[model samples]
Each structure stands twice: as structure tokens, then as C-alpha cells.
Target: MTTLIRYRDDAPQQALESSTDGAVIIERLAALGVGFERWSTSRSPLPAAASADAILAAYAAEIARLREQGGYTTADVVRLTPDHPEREALRGKFIEEHTHSEDEVRFFVEGGGAFYLHIGDSVYQLLCERGDLLRVPANARHWFDMGPRPRFTAIRLFTDPAGWVGHFTGDGLSARFPRYGEPYAGA
Candidate 1:
């Protein structure tokens, strides 16, 4: 299920708002200049272990639309499994707060992850599941958590030829909030 929990940056112990409803999620994220939508996953027969080429082909239409709409030039698929040798290292790289020079767009084909966006005075914890397409605006302060046993296949779109790159915030605010799969207990 896809979920969105909005909390005050200084008050991580309590959620200002939370919902699993797609419409609500979309509206909430859109208000923050972040795009969120559910794409139909049945466009092609995509297995959990689908290849990048296969995954790209499965959503070519949607990809084209996003490319036109967002001026995105390239798209790729990234899959990380529990058995991946560098899962821990990769997860660690993204769990810290960071920002990209270009928009960070992703379509979740399988499994899930969480994107913590620190915008203004609020931190929106967006849990993206299968079929969820989330577009975090360029230069948005955020970080991602793929969990300890990451098992997700995501299609990523990039406007830059160099693709995904993060600029760490060095604020260490991410550590103050609940991580992926952790129970949200407010202080």
C-alpha cells in the first residue's frame, strides 16, 4: 500500500496528517510541488526480477508522457534485492538527507521504499509501493530508505545525462525520524 505521513520537522513523534488514500496522497504531495500518482502496472507482464529493458518497455507510453511533461531525457531501471551484495552500502548512501540538481523521478514496479522530504517546516514521509510514481522536484531536500532487506524494482527518470547524484545536507535531521519499517512513535 502507498502511504503519506506529514509531520512537523521538529515534532517527529506525532504526524500532522497521514493517509493511505491515493487521492489524498496525490493532493498532499502536489501541494508541495511534488507529483504523486498511481500508474497501472498491468500494461505488461513484468516480473519482480524484470530486466531494465523489459521494465522500460512495459511503461513506454507513461515514460514518454513524463519525459515530455518534465523535460526528462533518459530513463533506467534500478533493482536491489535482499541478496544483493551491496544492499547495505547502497541503502546507507540514500538514508542520509540529500538533494539532486535535477528532479528525482521514480516509478515503483515492484516492492517499495520511503522518501522523506524535508520541505519548509514539515517532513513528508512518503511510502511508495508498486504502481506508485513519485516525482520529487529538483533541489528538493530529501532522502530515501529502501529498508534493510531492500527488494524493489524502480524505473528512474533523469533530466541530466549524468543521472542520479546526491548533494548531502550535513544537517543529520534524517536520523531523528523513524526509518523504513520502524514503528512511528512520537516523543
Candidate 2:
């Protein structure tokens, strides 16, 4: 299930609002200039690929539509498992609050993670599982946590050739917030 936790940016441990409903997640995110969509995995067949090129080729049609609609120029696949040695480094890098010049779009092909978007005075914690497609608008302050036991396959869409370039806010607020895989119910 997708979850949404709303809290004051300064008080991450105390949630002002929370929900596990999909419609509510979409509605809340949309109101904040973010886009959320749940795709049917059965409708889009994703073949196992050994290379990024093959992965992109397998989902060419879907990638094409998203690229055209969002004006994105590049598409790629990122897969990380529990045994990945770089899991900690990856988690640490993204756990810092940051913003990108181009919109950050990700479609979860498998597994799950959490996206913490700091907009206005509230932080929106989004737990995205398989089939979840989340688009964070350009320059939106956010951070992602893939959990300690990372396990996910995502298709990332980018507008720039440089791909993802984050401008870290160095606010250190992410440390106070809940990380992925934690018990977020009623948070």
C-alpha cells in the first residue's frame, strides 16, 4: 500500500496527517504540484534485461509516451538488491534534502522506497511500492530513502543529458524524519 505522512518540516517525528489510501495520496501530492500514477504491471510486460539498453528497449513504448509527455530526453533502469554493497552509500547520498533543476520521475518496476518531499512548511513522506509512478516537479525540495535492505527496480526519466544533479540543501532535516521500511502506520 502507498502511504502519505504529513508533518511540519521542523518536527519530523510528529505527523500532522497520515493516510494509506491511494486516492488520498494522489490528491494530496497533486495539490502540491506533484504527479502520482499507479500503472498496471500486467498491462506492461517487462522482460528481464542484462543491460540498461535492453531494459529501455523492453519498455520502449511506455518510455516514449512519458518522454513525449514530459519532454524528457533520457530513460534508464536502476536496480538494487539487499546484498548490494553500495546500499548504504546510495541511501546516504539521497537521504540529504536536495533539489534538481529537472523534474525527478521514477516508475517502480519492483520492490519499494520512500520519497520525502519538503514543500512549503510541511514534509510529505510518500511510500511508493511496485507500479507506483511518482513525478516530483523541478526544483522541488525532496529526498529519497531506499531502506537499509534495498530492493527495487525503477525506470527513471530525465530531461537533461547530465541526468540527476542535486543541489543539496544541507539542512540535515532528513535525519529527524523516518526512514524507509520503518513502521509508518498512524505516523
In order, what lDDT does every prediction score? 0.89, 0.86
Q: Per-residue alpha-carbon lDDT of model 1 for 1-187, expressed as tens digits?
A: 7889888999888888888989998988898999998998776447555778988988999999999999999999898888999999999998899999899999988889999999999999998889999999999999999999998889999988685689998989898888888878542
For all predicted structures, in order, the TM-scores are: 0.95, 0.91
Quick one: best TM-score, which candidate? 1
lDDT of 1: 0.89
- Which portions of model 2 show Cα errors greater than 4 Å? 43-58, 185-187
Query: What tens-digit string does per-residue lDDT give for candidate 2 at 1-187?
Result: 7888999988766788988888888898999999998877764445544467766676678789888899999888899989898889988887899999989999988789999999999999999998899999999999999999998889899998585788999899888888997764345
Q: Candidate 1, which ten residues in sequence have the lowest lDDT sum?
A: 42-51
Name the lDDT value of residue 186 in candidate 2.
Answer: 45
Clashes per candidate, residues 3 or more apart or on different chains: 1, 0
Q: What is the C-alpha RMSD of each candidate to the true structure, in Å?
A: 1.6, 2.0
Model 1 stretches with alpha carbons more than 4 Å out: none
